[model samples]
Target chain A: MARVIVDVMLKPEILDPQGQAIARALPRLGFSGVSGVRQGKRFELELDGPADEAALSDVRKMAETLLANTVIEDFSIRVEE
Target chain B: MARVIVDVMLKPEILDPQGQAIARALPRLGFSGVSGVRQGKRFELELDGPADEAALSDVRKMAETLLANTVIEDFSIRVEE
Candidate 1:
């Protein structure tokens, strides 16, 4: 089986309160120096066969449809050989 | 700013219905060949300065506290130089 990796991140313009919360909490925890934090997602797919164009295309469509909200997020895919 | 990448994934024994759903939906969408799916999370911290050991240790503590549930999830940290 092949592996498919998808990385999803929020757009820079979007406000990520979760990340901001991390940034703010850091100082309190005595860990200063972190300017910011951005939280995202990663998905791995174990395909039954080879990682080919058709599988990639289908996964892309799936990303657009379910994995991400195209309006405020962006995603990239990498298929392992 | 330096970057800290955290990769979080479900433990092998845990059930991931969300991923299973994706596997089931793929064939219906006319995209066969996927054997399994696993979903995880990634957090990127844009530090104000260099990614040192102290910063990493702090982030690891935070991961244990807020970022992940140690019960069923496993997380690893990578600090960018």
Candidate 2:
């Protein structure tokens, strides 16, 4: 089975409260030196066939339609061996 | 500024309902051939300096203590150019 990875992250212009919270919490937890943090989603898909052009195309459509909200988030896809 | 990527994923044995929901919806949406799906989290961290061993070590602690629930999830870290 071929595996596909899709990473969906909020646009740089959008404010990410989740990321801010982590940045704020870091110092208190005794971990420092991190300047910024952004949290996002990752999807791993198992396909029945090879992750060729056709499969990747289908995955892109899936990412655009179901995996990510394109207006506020952007997604990129990668195929795994 | 150096960037580090942390990808947190559910344990292989754990049940992923969110992934299952997406898998079920794929066929109805006219997308097929996907056998399974797993959903996870990705964190992008910006640091003040290079991603050296010390920095990666600190990030690992962050991932274990805050970013990932070690009981049910596993995380991997990568340094980005």
Candidate 3:
């Protein structure tokens, strides 16, 4: 089965509270030298069949329409065997 | 400057509520044949300096120490020039 990886991230201009919370917790956890932390989302999809260009296109549409909020987030897709 | 991409995902045994929400929304968005969506996190870090093996190790530690929750999540890191 084909596997696809998708990444979704908030727009740079947007304030990411989740990322900020993680960043604040880092030093307390004993990690220093880390400056910024932006939180996003990752998705792994296992296709029932072979992944083709058409299937990928459909997935892209899915991402735009439902998987990602285009108004505040961006997404990327990677397909693998 | 060097760039690094980090992906964090929930353990397979963990039920992902966010993923479930997204999966449920797909059919309404006109995407069929899509089954599962497990949500995770992605981080893009711009290194303050060159990225070497040592730096990568440090970043890995950072991920373990703060960026990811070992109890429920796993993470992968990639560095690029």
Candidate 4:
């Protein structure tokens, strides 16, 4: 089996309210000297076989249809042995 | 300068409600055969110098203070040249 990692993040042009809220709360949370906070999502998938083109295509479709909101976010997938 | 990547995830024992919700919505979103959806956070930081002990300490403090909710999450930091 292979391990697949997917990262989903809001596009730079999109306003990430979640990230903004977290950034605003940082100082109050006792953290100092921190500036940007871009929130994103990570997914780990245990694939049934070798990491191949077909698996990649399925994963990409998964990201587009469910894992990410393509209208506001972008995603990248990484595969590991 | 160095690039630092931080990955934050819900501790295995902790229930990830957001992940669960996303997993539940996947089928409706047209993704089949997706069973798990463990969500996490990623932060990319461009440090002011070569990644050194001091910089790592600062980043750790940031993770503990703001980047992650210690009660439910664990984090790992990776430094890239």
Candidate 5:
């Protein structure tokens, strides 16, 4: 089976409440050096079949349509054995 | 400024309801090639100082204590310009 890793990140202009909350929590937790934090999503997909060219294309299509919100987020895909 | 990326993933034995929900929704959305999906969190941290060795060590400490749960999750850190 071939494994695909998809990273979905919000656009630069978007405000991430989750990240902001984490940033705020860090200082209280004694980690005062961190200036900012942005949170995103990562998806690891194990495909049923081969990791061929066609499979890569199919995975990209899936990422574009379902895994990420194209208007507000950007996604990147990588293949791992 | 320095950027650090932290990858947080649940343990293999842990049940990921979010990933399961996404997998189930994929077929309904007409993207049926995905066999299994595991979801995780990605954190991008912006530090106030340079990306030096000291900064790297500090960030790793932050990840170990606050960014990941060692009992049920694992985290990896990376430095980027």
Candidate 6:
């Protein structure tokens, strides 16, 4: 089975409180030099067939319709060998 | 500023209810051919310096201590150019 990866991230203009919290806690834990952080979602989909153009197109539709809330997030899809 | 990506995924044996839920919904929505789905988290870190060895080391510590729960999850780190 082929694997498709979909990364769904918040829009650049959106505020990510979870990411900010991590950023704030880094220095306290002695891990510094991180200026910012943005949290997102990643999905690994195992397809029943090869990762051809048709499969990619299907994945794109799935990502747009369910995997991401397009009003606030953007998603990118790629096939992993 | 350099960007580092940390991908945190649940262990293969761990239960992923959220991903399963999505997988169940896909076929009903007319998007088929997906055999399995696994959901995870993606974090983008904006570093204050170049993505040198030291910065990567620091990110590894960050991932182990804060970004991932080692018991049931695993994380991978990469530098995004």
- Model 2 lDDT tens row, A16-77: 99999999999999998999999999999999999989999999999999999999999999
Give me the runs in candidate 5 sitting further than 4 Å from their true place: none
Cα lDDT of candidate 2 equals: 0.97
lDDT of 6 by residue, A1-81 (tens): 899999999999999999999999998998889999999999999999999999999999999999999999999999998
Tens digits of per-residue lDDT for model 3, B1-81: 677778889999999998888778887777767677788888876566667887788789988877789899988899855
Model 6 residue B20 distance off true place after TM-score fit, in angstroms: 0.6
TM-score of chain B of 6: 0.97
Worst 10 residues of 5 chain A by lDDT: A26-35
Give each model a TM-score.
0.86, 0.99, 0.85, 0.79, 0.88, 0.98
Candidate 5 C-alpha lDDT tens digits along A1-81 = 888999999988999999999999987877766789999999999888877888888888888888899999988888876
True contacts kept of 3: 0.55
Worst 10 residues of 2 chain A by lDDT: A72-81
DockQ of every candidate structure:
0.71, 0.95, 0.58, 0.44, 0.73, 0.97
Worst 10 residues of 2 chain B by lDDT: B47-56
| Chain A (candidate 2) TM-score to true chain A | 0.98
In TM-score terms, candidate 5 sits at 0.88
Candidate 3, residues A6-63, lDDT tens digits: the string is 8889999999998788777877877655577788888887666667888888889888
Task: Give TM-scores of the second chain, every candidate.
Answer: 0.89, 0.98, 0.93, 0.86, 0.89, 0.97
The digit string of per-residue lDDT tens for model 4 on B1-81 reads 777778999998989887788777767776555556678888766565666888788889888877889998999999856
Global CA lDDT computed for model 1: 0.83
Ranking by TM-score: 2, 6, 5, 1, 3, 4
Task: Give the candidate order by descending DockQ.
Answer: 6, 2, 5, 1, 3, 4
Error of 2 at B76 (Å): 0.4
Worst 10 residues of 4 chain B by lDDT: B28-37
How much lDDT does each candidate structure score? 0.83, 0.97, 0.80, 0.79, 0.87, 0.97
